[model samples]
Target: MIGRIMKIVSRQYTLLGENGEKHDAILMGKVRRQDVPAAGDLAEAEYVNGRWVIQKILPRRNRLIRPSCANIDQALIVMSVKDPDFSPALVDRISMLIMKADITPVLIITKCDLGIPDETEEMIREYENGPMKVIRTAKDEASDEVAAILEGKISVLTGQSGAGKSTLLNTLEPSFHLATQEISKALGRGKHTTRHNELHSVAGGLVADTPGFSSLDFSHVSASELGSCVPDFIPYLGKCRFNDCIHQNEPGCAVKEAVESGSVPQRRYRNYLGVLEIIQNRKEKYL
Candidate 1:
């Protein structure tokens, strides 16, 4: 039987069969040594001696490194306007990873009632018109647009700790009642709230509320490939005078030109540079 892994806990997997039937299965020892199954993974399982064991994980369309999950249709890059504060660098980093994996990235800004800073507001306007779509909503007001987008799709929530990933889900569906925590004032960040990645049924779609990311892994991406991953840089990509342009300090770079002409938001461009540096540093460290 092929079933979707709803959740894994204590080395036991709760799988939802293709026909909506549920099964409690264990991973085959050989498969576990080779590869482990993720929350959203569809695996080949079998009932032998009255025990279901997952034999293998099917090929994944995409996978996220942090809060690891597989085969995502879209990722909700949730960020807050206040409290933990809106983070463009973090948002850009997450979006790039999602885009590189060939998954659609949607920006969901929460905590609007806290008020958007002038800089944050500018960033919002750019992202709204930028490559990915942005959905603005308060911590209290759930978005119908988001609800509509969720239907029949597999979506995952990724953002900072206090950005209200679980809170947004709770607002969308009162019954989820997912755990949420307050931002730590002394540390000036959100405390870890979500422990494990679990899929929930909402709006006829499966949504996974994975642990929020304070740090990201850029190991799967390369420096030269980074520019192409930025959605804002796509149109001006191949138009650069030099075919090898990474859009940073390169002569006759169309992307940098677009940044100067305001075709791309300056803030987003800066964030891109910041991530590019990070990726380059990581590569250098390894070499």
Candidate 2:
């Protein structure tokens, strides 16, 4: 009668029932109007008239925007050093978004066998040295770094396509065998392989491999609220000269001073400023 929707495809969901029978279910009207029933959703369903129909969707602990998944424990952000390359700004923004949503963010740098780009290495050190945890993964290696990071967690994989998110998942659980794509030669990017967000069982955890993007819009986060998203800035937030410090060029600003004194990663501060500008120009968009 009740089950969790494991996967949704062609308007049909694969529901794992309490009785342990996985059935193909169609959504009823009331259930469809409530919210998108993402994978891992505890839902009410029934086999009526010889067809399964989802009847209800339970509340979610958290939801990711682009991927549109719910009840996430944390997120693993994959970035490559070569092929499609890496973007530190994108990494910082996504990491900040995770923190703002009260979800832990773990950084995974892939393609380590090919070696890391200078800027990519710098970003890795920045994350590892600061409040966030970082891990480096390589192809064809027996490194369980990603699995160790995701142990007992419902972690989502996000990055530019070809950043090796799927590859990392395959390494974690060889049986998953999710589709992966090669970088485009003409466009110098990766072709999309993951079509929709679906949960895959990993080593003692679940992972969502979603479509990659060139960049993510932070229009949902505000300028003032943006500083709080950077976990390292919390300690110096109230110590500023003015309570309304935006941490820019404000007089007696502790955040800016920390940036200058190497307390916070300079690149992170720069990324924060860039986000601040975007948030300022489009303040209402975020609010």
Candidate 3:
């Protein structure tokens, strides 16, 4: 029989069977010898001698390395307007990672009640005009739009530590009772409350709450492949003067021209250059 893994605690895996029954299963020796199944994995399981054993893990559609979740349909890139301050670069990086995994990226802006900076608001506007869907929510008000977007999609919620990812999750499902902590005034960040990635049924879909971090590294991404990760640059990619243009100081680069003409957000372009530099440096170090 095949079942979806709901939770993985140590050696035990809680699987949701096809018949709506929950089964506590253990990995078979052969399966254990290979790769271990993540929480969102679908596996072949058997019930023998009153014990359920997972024999094999099926193929995954997409996987996130940081949160360690598999088969995600979309990524909710949460960002705060004030507290830790919004970072467009972080959003760009995470969105790129999500796109690389072939998952849709959705930008969720939190803390709107605190008032968003003019520059940040402008940035949000630019992202809305881009590829991904953007949603803004506040602590005082419920976001029906956000709830509607989550419906029927397998989403992974992730962002900076103090960005209120857990708080937003609780607001979406009041009965969730997910533990949330106050932002440390001295550190300008919230305490890490989500220790592991676990999927919960919410808004007619499975949502995974993941550990938060302030920064992300693109060590796995190569400089040559970095341009494709930026969704906004797709339109002007082939229009560049050079067929193999990386869009950095290259003459007649359509992307650079777009930035100059204000067609592309300057902030996003700057962040793209910054990320490209990092990827290039990593590539050089390996060589």
Which candidate wins on TM-score?
Answer: 3
Error of 2 at 124 (Å): 1.9
| Alpha carbon lDDT of each predicted model | 0.84, 0.77, 0.82
- Decide which is better by TM-score, 1 or 3: 3
Location of the lowest summed lDDT over 10 successive residues in candidate 1: 182-191
TM-score comparison, 2 vs 3, better candidate: 3
Per-residue lDDT of 228 in model 2: 87
For residues 26-45, what per-residue lDDT tens digits would candidate 3 score against the true structure? 99988888886787889999
lDDT score for residue 125 of model 2? 83
Model 2 segments more than 4 A misplaced: 17-21, 117-119, 183-190, 212-215, 284-287
Error of 3 at 187 (Å): 16
Q: Which consecutive 10 residues in model 3 have the weakest lDDT in total?
A: 182-191
lDDT of 1 by residue, 1-287 (tens): 99998888879999988777899999998988988678889999999999998999999877765667788899899988888888788888888887887888899999999878898898788888887889998857878998999998889888988788889898999888787774334445445777677888887789999864446777788888998889888898899998888888889999989989999988888988888888888888889
Using lDDT as the measure, which candidate wins? 1
